[model samples]
Target: MLVNMKKILEIAEAEGYAIPCINTPNEETVRAVIGAAEELNTPIIIDHAQVHDSLIPIERIGPIMLKYAKEARVPVCVHLDHGSDYEFVMRAVKVGFPSIMYDCSALPFEENVEKVAQFVKFAHAAGITVEAELGIMASTDEDTHDDDPEKRVLTNEDIREFFTEPAEAKEFAERTKCDALAVCFGTMHGIYAEPPVLDIDRVKELREAIPDDTRIVMHGASGVEFDQVQNAITAGCSKVNYYSYMAKATTKFVADKVAETDGKIAYHELQEAAYEFMKGYAKDVIKAFKNGK
Candidate 1:
């Protein structure tokens, strides 16, 4: 069933698990992600990143995502990920996305709050859920969503500067009235320069301070250790954004499969095999985020 992101996240928060929010820029990935959720009988969120507009415009993929979501056996939320620009976010809304991340974290705190608060009012009136980011999330070279190459070299130490303050998180959530708030604790986007260490305590603090109606979100969960990821979920994160590593792994898997087949596999067959692999990969991700639930 197709549902709003807030509906699924409320359930996740109450059930002591986090929903895995994965980027599905293409048809294969969309099918694979929803297929995994159906097999596990769990709710999943499949998002289209604004950065991927170059690859496939939302106009082209939005209906397809919604169609798949409506047909899926388990609940699925079609979301707009990292929609920084107002016009781009409106585009997602126009395309009928049930959830949107109106990221203005790069702006001053007051400006970010004002922008999101205004959007939240309009979004709520339309019965759409809005997610806002409180802190700047660093990105690595492998993160295609981040166009700035300088972000790629940021180390764990550098990421600490971007950690969301618990008090500010509460204020932001309260002021904006966002359904979910993505906050930086330790993880950075893409492959980590070093094994990332999550500020589990920070997660707990943010959870306690933030309004109950606003679920806490953790972005850049791809390269973090499973145990740490689960710990964050237990501490408070009800929505975890994961991708970079999964995409990298899929590429390697396809390459290896072609080599094993000695280049004899047909193109369609290769695509099918990749889809199957991603389905299984997404299943493991969902299970991990379940935190043993």
Candidate 2:
């Protein structure tokens, strides 16, 4: 079913595990994620980012993502991830991305919130859900990886100003009326050691501070202590974003498959394996969110 991001998050919260929001670099990758989601019999997220070449031309990926959501037997949400570009964001709304992440975390506090408020208006009017970011999370710029992930931390002092404080998050929600909030608390965009010691208690507190039904999103969410799948769900992270890992994992899977088959791997066979691997990953992740876990 083609549900909104809010519906998916509700499913996650009620089910006790965050839904896997996989990033697909291309058509094959898209198929791999959705295929896995369907095979696992769980709802999933298709995340799109303009800055990532793997996700250029939202015009191309948007419609295709929507199509897959419609075709899939399980629930799915098409999300525009971390795009600060106004024109591109508007375009995505027109093209119909059910959810959007306006990454103004890099901007000044007031400016970021102002811009988010403005866009929230635009998105809500269109019946599209908006996800606004706060507190910059650090990651390898690919240009700057001196090996210390600590170098990328958004100032702890600045974290409060950059994003809505837990008390203020509710007001921001009421004023901007955003459907979801992506708050930062020591997560990095790329691989980092030990998952940066998550303030899971803070997350729990924030969860209580927000509107009971409002969705909570966590970005830069890969590379953690426990499985990324399990930890987020337990922390009450409703919508978890996974990008770098999914694309890289897909590439690695293909490369290894080709090597193992001695270049004799057929196209369908490779995709089939990729799909199966992802499905198992999704199933394992969903299990973490299950009540017994």
Candidate 3:
């Protein structure tokens, strides 16, 4: 069934698990992610990143995502990931996204709170679930990061500077009334320069401090070890955004399959194989975040 993020995340929080929110920028990914959720009989969130707009505009993919969500055996939430621009976020709302991440973390704390608070009012009135970011999430993905080499190689200590303060998280959640708040602890997006170490204690602190209605969220979970990821879920994160590593793994899988087949596989066959691979990959992610629930 198609549902808003708040509905699923509420259950996740109560049940001691985190829902895996994956980026599905194309039809194959949409099918694979939903397929995985159905197979596991678990709720899943499939998001279209604003950054992937050039690859496939929300206008073109929004309905497709909603259609699949409505038809899926398990609940699925179609969300807008990192919708930094007001206009772009409105576009997702117009396209009928049930959930959206209105990221204003780059702005000053007061400005970020003001912007999200205003949007939350409008969003809640329309039954849309709003997600806001409290801290700037670091990125190692070349596409999302600066070209400066120094910026990409972040140590554990470097990431600590971006960690969300529990008291600040409480204030942000209370003021904005967001359904979910993404906070930085230790993970960075894309392939990790070094294995990411999650601040599990921070997650617990944030959970305790933030409003009960506002679920804690962890972004850049892709490269982190599954054990650490699950620990975070147990500590408090109810929504985990993962994708970078999964996408890269899929690419390598397709390449290896082509080589194994000596390039004799038909193009459609290759696509189908890739889709199958991703379905299984997504299942593993869902199970891991479930934290044995």
Candidate 4:
């Protein structure tokens, strides 16, 4: 069933589990995530990032996602993830995404909060839930491996000054009135070069400081282990965003299948194999995120 993102996250928060938020750019991935969620009987988030807009334009993809959500037995929320472009985010809201994540964390603190506040007002008026990030997350992806300093691991001083402070997070939430808040405690985008050291303690603090009903989102969670993810959920992460793992799973499946076929496999069969692999990956991830619920 199609459901509000805030309601789904609230349920996860109450149940002490994190809902898997998958960035899906096509129908295959969309079906994979939703199908796994239905089998698991857990709520799921289907997210579309701004960078992927060209590949799966909102005009075409939005209704397809809404249709999938409506057909699914389990709850599904169509969400726009990391929507840095104001016009594009508004377009997503207009296209009927239940949730929209406005990523303005790169801006000055006050400016970020102010801009989010403005968008939150507009989104809420349209009966759409809003998500905003406070701390800047580091990236290690192909597009930003070398140039972006924010992509590096969070230093001790960075944690204190750059990442979301519990007190400041409370203020930001209260002021922005966002339904969800994405925090950068100690995770980066893309595959990790070293083991990630998450600030589970800070997650606990943020949970205590923020409203109990407000959803706490953790981005850059793709490569983290299940145990660490469990700890984050225990601490208060209700929504965990993952992209790299799913992409990797699909890509690897197709590459291996093609090699095995010696270029003789039918294109449709290869696509089916990739889709099935993605579904399998989604099932495992959903189980891990929900602690085998």
Candidate 5:
């Protein structure tokens, strides 16, 4: 069914489980996610972005996602993920995605809030759900550098600065009225060479501090660690994002399957193979849910 994401996520939260916000590029990824959700009989969030569609258009991807979810027995939420551009966010909503995310993490905090507030207005007015980010969640894809001439790691303060108090987040919701919040919790995007660490205690504290109804989202959240995903879910995280790993799994599978010596491939030709890989990974996540809390 074409269900609203806010409702599904809240249901998952209250029911003592988290909805997997799986990244999808094409039909195979969607199918994989849906297959996993259906097997688990759990809610699923299928997320996409313009950055992702650098090859596959969102317009083509949207209907395919909606169709797969509608056909599935479990609930599904097709969400926009890390939307770097405003136009793509609007386009995703227009294309019938139930939820959209505005990633202003690159902008200064004040500017991020202002920009997110404006986007929230447009999204909420259209009866679509909006997700806003606070705190800097660095990823290899975006800004992550050192001061001077050395590479450095982000500190706890840097992570904390990206977050607003639960009250402030609630007020932002009241003012901009975003439907959900994505906070920085020490996880970086792309891949983590030294392992991704999420402050579970801080997450619990933040969750306790937020408004009861506000959904907490985690971005730069992929290649989910077994313990962290479960712990975050226990700590009031409703939506858990998975981007790089799943896409990586899919892309790698497709490349490995291409036996052509010419190193040439067509889109759909590879997408089919990629979809098979995505399905297996999606299934792995669902099975993880089954085995885990």
Candidate 6:
């Protein structure tokens, strides 16, 4: 059934489990997520990043997502992720996504609050829940980096500047009136070379600071240590966003299968093969989040 993040996460928070927020750029991935949720009988969030609009236009993807959510036996929330552009956010709202995350974490603190507050007002008026980010997340796509300076490892200075303070998180949630809060807790997006470290204590502080109804969300959760994830969930994180590892796993499977078949399979068949891998990965993630509920 189609649902909002507020209700989906409220149950997660109360039950001491987290729901996976998986991003999908196509029908294969969408089917995998929804199918996995059905098999696990768990709630899920399916999101599309606004930056990927060129590849998967929201206008086309939104309706299909709604169709999947409506048909799925488990609760599903269609959400717009990391939407920095105001016009694109409006388009996603028009497309009837149950939730929208307006990422203004790159701006000054006050400005971030003001911008997200406007989005919250607009979204709430349309009966949609808003998720706002309060910290900086480093770009994880290696292919998008420039050759000049090359990509540097994330530094402690960067973390200290961007990591959300408990008090600030409380203020941000109250100021924006957002339904969910995405906090930065040292996990960078994409593949991690040196292993990721999560501050579970920070998660506890954020939980105590924010309103009981405002759910805590973790970004860059794809490659984090599962034990750390368990700790965070135990510490009151109710939602975790994941995607990069799913893409990597699916692509690897498809490429290996193509090589195994000597490139004779049709494109659609390759996609079907990839979908199988995605479904497996999604199921594992769902079970992990729910602690095998």
What TM-score fits each model?
0.97, 0.84, 0.98, 0.93, 0.82, 0.95
Candidate 4, clashing residue pairs? 138-150, 138-151, 139-151
Model 3 TM-score (2 dp): 0.98
Worst 10 residues of 5 by lDDT: 142-151
Question: Can you write out model 2's per-residue Cα lDDT over 148-227, one digit (the tens) per residue?
Answer: 65565544343333333677666666666677888766566765544355667667777888786677777766555445
lDDT of each: 0.93, 0.71, 0.93, 0.85, 0.72, 0.86
Query: How high a TM-score does candidate 4 get?
Result: 0.93
Q: Which regions of candidate 4 are displaced past 4 Å?
A: 145-161
What are the per-residue Cα lDDT tens digits for candidate 1 across 34-130? 9999999999999999888988999999999999999999999999999999999999999999999999999999999999999999999998999
Once fitted onto the true fold, the runs of candidate 6 whose alpha carbons sit more than 4 angstroms away are 147-149, 155-158
Residue 231 local lDDT, model 6: 86
Alpha carbon lDDT at 145, candidate 6? 55
> Of 1 and 3, which scores higher on TM-score?
3
- Expressed as tens digits, the lDDT of each residue in 56-174 for candidate 5 is 88888888988887788988888888787888887887789888888876777567778888887777677788888876675555333434323344444444555545655555555
Query: Scored by Cα lDDT, where does model 4 land?
Result: 0.85
Off by over 4 Å in 5: 142-170, 251-274, 289-293
Model 3 residue 183 CA deviation (Å) reads: 0.5
lDDT of 4 at 126: 76
lDDT of 4 by residue, 1-293 (tens): 98878889878977889998998888888898899998888899998888788777998888889999999999999999899989999889778898899999999889999999999888888778888998877776665556765655544344444568999899999899999999978777877767777889999999999886568899888888879888998899999998897798678778888889898999988877788899889999989988766
